[model samples]
Target: MTDMQVQRHAPIREQVANILRDAIVDQRLTPGQLLVERELCEMTSASRASVREALRQLQAEGLVESHNGRGTSVTVISTATARHVYQVRSSLEGLAARLFAEHASDQDRAAFRAAVTELAEETAKGADAAALLKAKSRAYDVLFRGCGNPVLHQTVQTLQHRVTRLRALTLAQEGRAERSADEVTAIADAVDARDGEAAQAAAMTHVEEAARVMLAAAEGPPSH
Candidate 1:
């Protein structure tokens, strides 16, 4: 667990939840791993009450599960569940792309292009998973901001944690990181041209390809 300095001005439970969320998405806390409340309290230097609240928040976000006796564990995303997530993600991202292309300011478009360039450079250099994920997230932030719809942004943000975890899985596949960068570049290009339809198609295609790679990887080696 990373060291956390609780901000005196902010709510501790929210801070704790964000910390735990990042750990899960970064794969530091693997799926199905038991998350003991006591250990979490110690790790975050938070009180039991705060830790429990954070766990509750994570559970609501679908990042963790609780059972009567099994305790709390990180949620294991099945291939079927992953497919559903990707379907929704495809629609949301497609809409965001189209909105950005049609309504974003010139400054927003320039910032998005710069973000995509950083993502592409990171992938080309074979940066670690964490770095690549951060770069991609920066690009996404630009997209969400340029979309100019708080409701759409909030809706997508709700699924951010789960989508990030699946993104890590896809990035681990051989050659996937490079292709993923290219896909984003395509979306960026269409956005720059203010081509709403093309941008939406590229964004949806990116999500679809990521789903394909992730589901295939989950299947493991086929029997001879």
Candidate 2:
């Protein structure tokens, strides 16, 4: 079926949720921006039921918050919260890298290398944030698949979605993209060489760098 038809045939709430999630992550719906139910329905051409259901899902994901009188708004990640999130992410990613190094077959390693190359090329070409997010996700897909832990993979996916906005912010910082690409290359190199310890360290380093950039950007420049 065509994409449009597929959307119509699928569960309406998920379709609406995906559209709203993309908007929030892409910053079209900025942090602290109010989510008006009527406006969302109008924008997505979905019904009230679908919009409300979608908002409920996003609220559960920590991407949207609702106050009794104030309604819902995109979540704003404070520096402290970002730091905590990164701490958890670093540990989980370290475990993932070590596991991948231990478990990845030749074919899996080849796919991981291909994903790294695609991400590097995209970064060098100065791809937009959305394109870069997709490319980065492709690389993570290889890691997730090779790691051999469904529970860990699913947990990381949830956490990744929660931090998508912060991640996009980090990617926008000056020189951050090149640095991030290099970090991923380091992780890939360690995995290729079958050094589990080095791979884990490389993955942790990448998360640490991302946390640094994201926290600094979230804080904004200090006033003179």
Local accuracy of candidate 1 as per-residue lDDT tens digits, 3-56? 654555779999889888888988778899999888787677788898889999
Sequence-dependent TM-score of model 2:
0.93
Instruction: Give the worst 10-residue stretch by lDDT in candidate 2.
Output: 1-10
**Tens-digit lDDT string for candidate 2 (24-116):** 998889989998888887777789888999999999999999998779999987778889999998999999999998888989989998999
Question: Model 1 segments beyond 4 Å from truth?
Answer: 1-10
Error of 2 at 144 (Å): 1.5
The pairs that clash in candidate 2 are none
Q: After superposition, which runs of candidate 2 have C-alpha atoms over 4 Å from their true positions?
A: 1-6, 222-224
Report every candidate's CA lDDT.
Answer: 0.92, 0.88
